[model samples]
Target: MLDFRHISAARRLVPVLLIALALAGTTAHAASGPGASSKGLRLAAMLGSQDAAKRAKGLSALRAWGQESLPGLLAAMEAPSAEVRRGAVMGAALQPAPALAMESLLNALGDPDATVRSLAAHTLARLGPLAATDVARLLASPTHDIRVAAALCLSRMGPDAVPALAAMMRRDDPPVQANAAWLLGGMGSDALPAAPALIHALDTDDTRLIHVIAEALDLIGPDAATVLREMTLISARGNRPFSRMGAAAAPTLVKLLSRPGTPMGQMALFTLARMGDQAKPALQDALATGTEGQRAAAALLLTGIDPNMAHTLPEDLRRTLGGAIHLN
Candidate 1:
């Protein structure tokens, strides 16, 4: 079984996935002249070809045709060949008007092939803010598969999708509620405005919901810091305490660290480690003769705070504090 305690703390230190706009738009030949029809037809046909070279050639031709191929590409999304369908979607992705291109991608979202659906989701996400309305529609779709795809796409849309996400939070479904919390955190500061909803979610007894909301609050930073601090205090006395609370609240909980001889200060240092370099100076000062637990927490914080600073800390300090301590 996963150690729920340490997992929450590590989650804050973990890096957010790299947002790769793979289909955002890539280079393609600009089509022209009477041969454009021939090129487009050839590309459409290549979408189903067994030969990889021919398929590549087909993609090249359709991309060359640009916006002119939108209608044909839309029609080709239903092609028996999954490759053709995916190729058609990719071709549309390269067009200046992806809104039109995405119609086929949206339909392709229901493709029996999981690979095709994942590709469509990734492509729509790459379209960024333009995919917002489509993603919102996906969230409301009858199929959970579509909803998941939409949620994933919106998560990648960053801050732009927060308004729509905040609206979705009103729904009582736990999956929707949980995903909304995750996406809000994935967006960072743009999600600052979502503090109230997350704070309310944190009050729920559901560990899943509370942990996710706590993570989101960290992403929202100090704007949501005080609530997390209060919750930490509440949790400290509750049946289920939140050891990771201070680490998540590190950036905004600086004042807690400034006061000497406080438990909150130790928590702040742990949180600072999660925030890395941003929490450095405070962590350095807090390291002074605290306890084995405090020093160990500082060592963990230093590992990721800043690569340069990590080198500055003496090896003896790291070795002395190498063992882990229970956060509570």
Candidate 2:
């Protein structure tokens, strides 16, 4: 009974109405949650987009989705492009609960690209103490770069890294020992517990290692005062094994005299000025009987701690220090 023209128009409009309804459904689904699998695929593709801006937007959206973004990011980690893999790692780090992506991040640590590996390590660090166990494993890797990256990540975890770093200090490998020392030093007073191990390592003949150990001791601040003073005295005596200890302690010693206007500062200055006298037996012995280099070293250190004593020095000792004593 309907007109042919009207029937033809209704048929033509049927497909257009169906398409609009489908788009509306999709829009509503996207608005509700990222639970739709298609939405996830689209986001993942966006993350791997060659355009940097699109990748950044995808990362932002994924972070907004929170835990919902984890699976897609995990999948993106295996993207053929190293760039996509790097982006995935970064996106994982930006999630509201980064620890949720820990497994994916741990796997990314062994990525072929160095930058990706480094980024993965840093991302784990951003997860804080929660990433400690996985990061600890990387420390044992035979690869130097991986070990170093792990050390850096542990350093960023603050006090939580103490146990792992303290253990590393005992390793026979010099680089391992050096990296551990550097991180411990970065911890400041928190690293006081590792002082004994660091002091023990100072027995090495490597000047580089010695320098790092001294720096670590210095960074431990007043907590290391007792050890510092002992090492300083030994170094002052011109002992070969502890030769570089004095130079290492110089900055910390000077800090003690920083508040020259305060009572504590006055005490520090007094103690430093008399350090030469306290070590007088060694100093005198060196000036009276040691070689030119030994006497020069002893006199120079003495003159540094106490300038007034310069007049009392023997002619030869004075000459060894290059004429009148001058403290830089």
Candidate 3:
């Protein structure tokens, strides 16, 4: 939430903090590491500025100190003034390795101010894997926004985040489950271990949850293919609607082309077309069968796969496939 005015104020306080740190026996040449620098002390002072504008100036100054301002910023986090503590947390997050701010950020997670907590979550999550531990801690936080921040961070972290994400899947809330499933899908093969659970999630009575699980299956890829195939078989054999399963299994539908006798092969081709060209070979195979439904679905998929492929179909086939091609 730091804005233009805040940035200007931070710039103004840099000089003051540097001078104070210089007088306080801290120095760039000292073994104690990055100290207050004139920038940090003045920035800390601004935290006590009675005027909102002056306070913004202080926060802005601290943020500007960046990594070199860490020692001072860390000290400021313990300030009795709420503004100073908030400013310190904000400044620390701006460090290149935000992991350095993990402790301070974690403490701020329980701040009485909702805004501070939310900002802390945003910074930690954006830091990616560096903030993984803190993000995991926040996953169980009572606040919804904190949980959301953790989920988003885990999603961005991809596969490395699956363990924590999977653990949270046991929650009763469908939205939480849905986000967890989506993140697992993004993990690609790393998420293979979670395939069975994800597949099971697709069967939830909630159609919305089914969509989320299906999307996860698509992301889990080759790892989930066998499970998808089995699901397809069970659905077809039982004469189930298979709508949600088919929709979710879009990516795996292509494999059906390799297993001809399974009713799923052609049936999957049509759905693959719905998913786009990854199903090209399967659709091509379907085209040859030329039964009205098979040819029609093939033509539709071909247009999506490649317009050139659609044009390549014989005049007779095109005429026979007219309605399916959707040339318009």
Candidate 4:
């Protein structure tokens, strides 16, 4: 039984497999190489098979060839059958050499099948920094999926892409700086190398760029602790950065909580309690290994936010907090 109402909504969801490139001409070796053509034809048949086992068997053989699989994959990419083309896109990912993939998948960008195009982009992303510069160029693409894929691809490149982003940050342009910041944050802790650059970008006059940089710093969590530690709990300028920080700011807040009678301590408690679920892991870590003051502060904070979690505190910490308080 199918629900007719949900069918349109489901059909609109693009099966995002992701790939890219222009039809940069190179002779597809499998089309002419001895023995490769025969093997490639068999591979295309198995890869496009309706049976899962045959597909698995075909995929294993493709991976085993590593870079040697490139020619067959490229030849298969040109097949008249869209299913075989889609399978070729999947096969490209298994080898994932930029030298091979960039050429092998060039045809897939114009692939009429959306799934094949998406799968191609996804495979290209697996090429990491080798494909990052080209993909980063697409961040400003008018196409929504293209921009998303570019960002996703950059984020997955880890530390290797930081220097390129660090260079982008130096440009006088605001959008480029902001996008670089967003991508650095996307790299999380691997972004440590760019911290100095990020800190320097705070000199910009644009409020929007400033806000995005701050949010990006927040996304990098404690990696930006040098920045977070200095955030004034009262100022709008300072508080906004800290506010977007979620649990990453918990340790410093817990430190403020150590002096529970102070205004900073009260505000820290409120901020931690307001963070809800995001604060749990940090709070749990504090309870487990932090100083007595941190443990006590965490227990009191958790009691107001999550009584069940408060009750899970160690016997020593619970005794120190004089037992958890009732929310009511």
How does each model score on lDDT? 0.57, 0.60, 0.57, 0.61
CA lDDT, candidate 1, residue 207: 47
Off by over 4 Å in 4: 1-45, 48-50, 60-69, 78-82, 96-99, 103-118, 202-205, 221-328
Task: Assess every candidate by TM-score.
Answer: 0.53, 0.53, 0.43, 0.48
Candidate 3, residues 1-328, lDDT tens digits: the string is 1012232343335434433322332122211324564455456556444555655555455444456677776677666667666556556655667677777776665666544554455556566656665566565566765565455446556666666666656666676677677667767778877666665455444556655666666667643356755556434434564533443344344334333444345446545655565456646665665445555656666777688787777577788877767554
Per-residue lDDT of candidate 2, residues 1-328 (tens digit): 0012332343344334323322321111221334544444556565546665665556556645667767766777887778667656665666678788888788777778765666676678777767776687676677766665576568667788777677777777666687778878889999877776776566555556666766776777534355654555435544455453443433333333324344323433444445545555555565675456545555665677677667767876766665558534
Across residues 1-328, which tens digit of lDDT does each residue of candidate 4 receive?
Answer: 0112322332233232211111111223232235765566666665556666666566666655556766776788888888888777766665656447675553464567666665665556567677666666665555545554445446556676777677677777787688788888777778877765765565555656765665565566543245444442222254374445555556555555555654445556777887777777777778877667767888877776777665576877766666445422
Query: Which of candidates 2 and 3 is the stronger one according to lDDT?
Result: 2
User: Worst 10-residue stretch by lDDT in candidate 4?
Assistant: 17-26
Model 1: lDDT to the true structure: 0.57
Among residues 3 or more apart in sequence or in different chains, the pairs in candidate 3 whose N, CA or C atoms overlap within 3 Å are 9-57, 10-60, 10-61, 17-37, 17-38, 17-42, 18-37, 18-38, 18-39, 19-38
Per residue, candidate 1 scores C-alpha lDDT tens digits across 94-142 of 5678777777787777787654565566667677767676676566676
Worst 10 residues of 3 by lDDT: 24-33
Relative to the true structure, candidate 2 has a C-alpha RMSD (angstroms) of 17.2
